[model samples]
Target: MGKLTRILSTAALSAAIASVSLTAAADGTTNWRMATPWSGGPWLERDAQSFATHVRELSNGSINIEVFPGGTLGSALKVTDSVKSGVAQVSHNYINYDYGKDQTTALLAGHSSGLTPEEFMLWMYKGGGAELYEQYRLDKFGVVAFPCSILGTEIFLHSNKPVRTLEDFKGLRLRTSGAWAEIASRLGASTVVLAGSEIYSALERGVIDAAEWGSPEMNRPTGFQDVAKYVVLPGIHQSGGVLECQINKKVWDGLNPQQQTVLRDAAKLSVFDSWLSSSYADLKAYEELKNGKNEIVRLDPSFIKAVYEETTKWEDEYAGKNEWFKRVLDSQRTFKKDMQSWPEYRLQIGVSEL
Candidate 1:
């Protein structure tokens, strides 16, 4: 064959190889279903939706996630089970809701031991808390998890009657769950566990005297302000809330390295975005509540101190009972202790508080 004919044949072979490579890469595309523990319309649900959007965009549409807002697949509290059973490839929910399965779950979600939102984030990302959490999920549920959302301090409680001191808690029927419920019970308040959707009606019908949910932005959408005019502050039980995104282990393993990196970074971005958006919304909600008939009251300092003491005692007792709980608590305690000194030094150096 002549030189020109040989060159033409080589070019045609190169084109065919390129087409095959493109097809192989395109075949890696995936579509996943993600379920959240919150119903449609709340800031939390919006955060979950935003996370899905970020993942898709970051993956350049090679991976698409369809988010199912609260209870669409099943009860919100059972989201972990849904992901574990492969009913859903992913889920966004507070891990503390599953504290019944293992007390350590509360440490990842929200614990009353007094870590602020920033502190929790620091511990999770830098202080080795994230690794423990990931291991716990894999060992217990056969799933992979990430901290996808972080909430500012929650409102302590919303009440029909004013709560002035520890005495006021006597005979008060409260709707809450996890360690907070235990603390409330010790304080003489009868505690009941109610789903998020049930809180408004329960308060309106006088089924419960008080309840604590999310931040002002989250609670406003539930219309808690309308049902309970007296809003308490300084959420002592839950200083902050963390939402986790869990994926089925098989699904997570199927992802390529780049896809895994996108998922991880997308989750971190969601955590930051949710924190900022919720903080702004809470400020606005606070202003609106002030203008309305609602009265926002801060819990008395002495009462808060008492609650903190109780929380410490409860933490000791519970940690002694569960090995995993002890492991997480020890890790957080060490991180908190090490970081606590810096803030003191900063204050001494005259840095103004924010």
Candidate 2:
């Protein structure tokens, strides 16, 4: 689509998502409070609000969800905890936040940029990833999960210095999280851990040489470009991942069959809808940066190849230590291999063969 068309579509979707219809409570209505890690405006928050709206409509107002942006209900760090403790019946968040308890959670978020969006989507729906995700969440944290939002590829490095090559990353301090943090460390960069609010200042004060955040649209307003003039491409850290709707197990157990189905369907719908909108918006955001003061740096192909090799070694060691990691890793790798069949066949034949 053209830029103007995409812009208009994004604006319309934003406006529609801003206002969600909810009827007055009646008998049989199940009230839920959903806490999210985003304060407001970002598509992540919109994803949560959109899911709640869908649940209300699909359940015919039998389910009413109130979405609390970050810090309103609890700190971003405690979103999952809030849901588990019943302070909120549900939370919208990245599963990687629970990595302290289960390393497997990191794989679900982004395993070293392991799966591209195309492969990830196929694995999620057709390759049993949903079931594995649900099982892991319930086992690791007393909650049920449905992937409520899917992130597009993010910016790899927003830095004051050029980080286009593997050599440049050596001894460079960076701010990042999840599995990529460890991978970055092994790659000879000193990876720093910082909160979302601290990234800009960390870059401004020269505390971190670079940082990786979400998609372009999400990072634009954070003002990273003002502090760091280099915008790196192919966010190898998080090519894609899901933000989940994690429900309290007790509350989930109380849900009737139809209510449960409504929640699941709503999450699925929101994921698909958000992917389309986020992708278009992100592409538009990337295009706008073409003439900006920030210098765009593409990661060297060799750097990308090295990361793939390192990720496999790191994952293998973890798999040996953790069964869940092995299981999920196996599922993803198998699906990725299975997905290659079509491309391989197509390469061996001409279009005329069809």
Candidate 3:
């Protein structure tokens, strides 16, 4: 090549490198864009913010994350891919949001009658759940993840039609997400997948007959109570679940050990914070719903019994289909069985397990 051509090529390459370098922090600090699926200030959204606060406070300004509401960086439901593809360096996600990538994600996210919120947290830290999830996250999405926050059991359904029995769900059009949608379909409900924003309009216009969102505490302000005739209790479809923080693998690899620990510790703190806040908010939300016009309907024991039975079958069937599904299901089942008698012991001694 001519000297002029070679010189021009070198200069162009240098300019491209300099422009890319400018996206990083000038002070040698690590900056991240955290995309989350939640736009409203539900506990989920606050969980993302709370995690960022913990990271900032604990990292002492070395690692800074800018929070972006859902859809700011990409499709709210697809932020895990957004992180993987480098549209964002990090994301706060509902682990099951990536169910399309790997079905076992729902097992990580939590499912019907699997574990309570408290037990799920315990299992993650104490029962080898965390290690398995890290492996799964890395393998499935090429991201590093922590269970950053959790929700208590959600309301089963907020429906204009009363859903008190197992038969009541037959032919019912339900708006839901993740594994519940699959299981609900198996139980004779025609399940429709809708984002949080689409639920209200679909419900109001009779596009869906029923919907299940978050816990009563998380649901109160959504005005579901105003439109639905009945608010179903005791979130059987999902006992409880962890919300996840997903970081790009390359970004995670770049951080020093201390910065990594800061992120881990911050994620743990977010979980603890969410537990306390959800406990309080859910109590108040339950009372607030009691005063609202909607009729509060508790799922019949028979209905719950049937759902749990089907839930087990669902797990067992998937365990046969997917290796990760089997591993996660086995771990959860083992952890849950190991704690089976604790609730009875607590009740007999006048201590509440909750």
Listed per model in order, the count of residue pairs whose N, CA or C atoms clash below 3 Å is 0, 0, 0
Candidate 3 regions with alpha-carbon error over 4 angstroms = 1-26, 43-45, 347-354
Q: Tens-digit lDDT track for model 1 on 1-354?
A: 699998999798656533442132446766677877776765445788878989989998887777887777667779988787666778888888788887778777876778888787888899998788888888877889988888788888889988878998878899999888888899889999997879999999999999998777777778888999898888888898688888888778877899889988998999888877877788898788778889888888888888888888888997899888888888988997989777655554224665
Best by lDDT: 3
Q: Candidate 1: where is the Cα deviation over 4 Å?
A: 1-28, 43-45, 345-354
Local accuracy of candidate 3 as per-residue lDDT tens digits, 108-208: 88889658898989899999998898899998778899898987888888898998898998999999978888888988999998878888888898899
| Reference-based lDDT, each prediction | 0.81, 0.83, 0.85
Candidate achieving higher TM-score, 1 or 3 = 3
Report the number of the highest-TM-score candidate: 3
- The 10-residue segment of model 3 with minimum total lDDT is 15-24
Give one digit per residue, the lDDT tens place, for model 2 in 16-132. Answer: 543332223458676777888887765545788888899999999878888888887667877888888776778889888888877898778876645766556677888999889
How many clashes would you count in candidate 1?
Answer: 0
